[model samples]
Target: MKRYLMTPGPTPIPPEVSLALAKPIIHHRTDEFKKLFDETIKLLKSVMQTKNDVVIFSSSGSGAMEAAVSNLIGESQKAITINAGKFGERWTKLVKAFGGVPVELKYEYGDYAKAEDIQKAIEKNPDIKAVYIQASETSTATAHPIDEIGLMLKEKYPEIVFVVDGITAYGAIDVKTDRWNIDIGITGSQKALMLPPGLSIISISQKAKTIIKQNSNKYFYFDILGEIGAYGKFTPPVGLIFGLKESVSIILNEGLGNVFKRHSLLAKATREAAKAIGLKLLSKRPVDSLTAIVMPDGINSSDVIKQMKELGVEVSNGQGHLKGKIIRIAHLGYFFKPDIIVGISALEIALKQLGVEFNFGEATTKAMEIFSDE
Candidate 1:
């Protein structure tokens, strides 16, 4: 069966990236790998829209997330967490795990934390050390307004570090790290970087570096400073790093503006198609990365996802409490207009097969029209 993946992550690696991964491995201490590693860092810096030090790790994005908490905030510090979804709540968990206090500013599943909420949460507690948020919450399929929130935090509370989880937002969306005053930004390779899983790329501001220097956490594995000093000299997943090099090369050749434009257009088309098919969106404020559609009144999202997989098209089911209510269709990374068409087409058929349809071909036709206009 021919498979087309509409899942958010481990999205789909391009043929060129796959071939690059297949190349013969080389010693990490070699000059050749060092050069490739340096060039990869340069491209990553451009894509992140920051001048800070970009560090690559051998773990998933969550590793970097934990690093943010452990390295920035001390064991006794009280941090303000914006808990809007599963991933947002992760900050709270990480804080607790590291013996820190969490002053959580929470919102409902579909809703996002507002600027006022963040301001109030931080202002009400003067002892808050850092404000943690996710730029894009994958579980809720919502993109938080990090730029606006970051600006607000910097203006009102420059002393508190603003940490962001950019796992799903980094490459697909415009994350001007320096411009936004984000102290620490984290992302993984699989999501929008178009590489396979197992690599997490992070960028840290000088301010965050200073704080980390003071913390003196005994983290030898996820140590950002150590990783920076020993980046190219170690055998740190050289294959995936090579894949990341090709992945970053492709992203740069396409240009950042064009990349954003492509994701925006495709996401818009996906949302429109789902709306045309009479599916309700799970997120009140959806983003250009993925669209999470609410299943009809009594329908099970798990059933839908299962059927799509059986049909050789795979999409992700909702996370945590939304497992049976919503299905996500991702438009990030290496996908294009044609892939969107394939996804909506499969979804329409799957809906019809599950006896929950209103029209066939309508969604696909509309998506094609939208793509043609672009």
Candidate 2:
């Protein structure tokens, strides 16, 4: 049976991008690869919506996150971290791992971070050096108010660096990195770039570069400054770089505005369909990238996931303590309206097979209506 990937990360890759990945590899140190790398960086800035310097890493998105933390914050320096979900909590761990003190602003899993909360934290600790947050929390399918927080920081704390993990937001959501005053914006190739896992991209502003120059962080491989100035510091992932070029070309060809609208429509259709089937949404502030639905009482999300897999559909289960309680269906990357319809159809069948009581056909019908109007 053919499988459908509807997970948040490692999302479905486009055929064109897959083909690009299969192309003959080139030596990273040569002029040909350097030209491709430079073109890819330019395309990356367009997608990131930033005029800042961008760098590509051969590691996962978490590697860029670590680079942001380790390069910007020094030992004994204080920073603010938002912990609204699994990825949000990563900021806290990274800060602690790098010997920086983290003033964690914790929120409920499905909730979003408020600008006021961050402002309050900064007011309480005026010595904070940086603020780390996620543009979209993948685990909870929630989106934080990065614009509000960034603008607030721009007005109040001009010296403090603003780092955002836009791993799930970059291509799916319109995150105006430069306009939002995000000093460092990070994303992964797998989430919204319509490519396989292997590359991570980060946009660094001039302010962030200056901060890194002043800091004495003890990191060699994650050195952001060294990665700048012409070519990457180490041997780059040549195949993934070629794939990224194709992926960004596809995104640009579709136009970023249309890409975001397509994602929004798919997410809305999915959310409406879930509600029509009597399911509750997990995220209070849902993102366009994915929809997280709370499983019915006494229904295990793992079982639902298993049933969907048996039907050749793949969705993700909640992480950490919420596992087996919530199901996350992704509409990001290469997904379209028909994908959502098929996913909802499979979900309806799975729920019925599990003996859950709900209107069987209404979900698909509602989703079709939304897609028709789109």
Candidate 3:
């Protein structure tokens, strides 16, 4: 059986990156490591479309989310939070956990948060210090209109920092941090970055750096400012640092425009293929990172996942309330057209094996059409 990983992340790591990681580990405080570390940060900023400092952490994406709260906002500070997916819900939790007042702007699952809602929240709560959002809500498969929201925020409430959880959408979509006026943009290596789960990346604007000064939350390990100050002297995870360097090198070599275009083409192919197979898309404003398809009536998404696994393909099941209702197929990082073809073909066969009335060749044919057009 041919194997494939369609999970959102730790998406397949490129063999080249894996080989780099296998090198003998070196002390991070060494001058050689510092050079590589500095270069890695510069490359991260280039890919993230920001001139701000991009800080790296030896933690998951959640760590960056928490750091955004602890390092930026003070106790009892009010912030507008957009809750449309599991990741959005995480923003709410992180705010509350950090002793901030969370003014949640909720939306039903499977829908994007409206910019107008964000505006109203800011207008209603003039005391709001910041606006927290997920660039892509991976749980519900929705991509929030962050650019629109950012425009409104900058125009209306420039004081409110716009913190985005871009763990899934960072390299997968067009996240122009400087253009969109994003204050603090956070991502993880496991997602679109195509590395393992050990690294979290954060870009902090000069405005955000000011917020950090008054945050009052005492943090050490996740202290981004402290890390940046000591970058040339301190030790980081050397192996992961090398892995990140190699991964970012590959992405840069491919060119950002071409990388995004490839993801877009793969995403379109996946969505069109799903529709041709009579599957419903989960998110209204779907992100290019992954495609979530609603299972047919009486067919549990778990069953679909099980069948797909039997056929040597691995995709993610929905999270939280969406569990057992939708299956998420990712096309991010270390993936290309052939992988997309193989994955869709496996899904079609698996659905048939599970007694779902899907036309066997329809998805593959539609995907081919998409591939040709692209």
Give the TM-scores of the predictions, in the order they appear.
0.97, 0.99, 0.97
Q: Mind giving the per-residue lDDT tens digits that candidate 1 earns over 287-353?
A: 8899999999878988988888888899998888999999999989998999999899888888888
Clashing pairs in 1: none
As for candidate 2, its clashing pairs are: none
Segments of candidate 3 deviating more than 4 angstroms: 232-235
- lDDT score for residue 59 of model 2: 92
Q: Pick the candidate with the highest TM-score.
A: 2
Best by lDDT: 2
Candidate lDDT values, in order:
0.88, 0.93, 0.88
Please give, for residues 82-143, the per-residue lDDT of candidate 3 as tens digits: 88888888889988988889999888888998888888777788999889999989897788
Instruction: List the lowest-lDDT window of 10 residues for candidate 2.
Output: 224-233
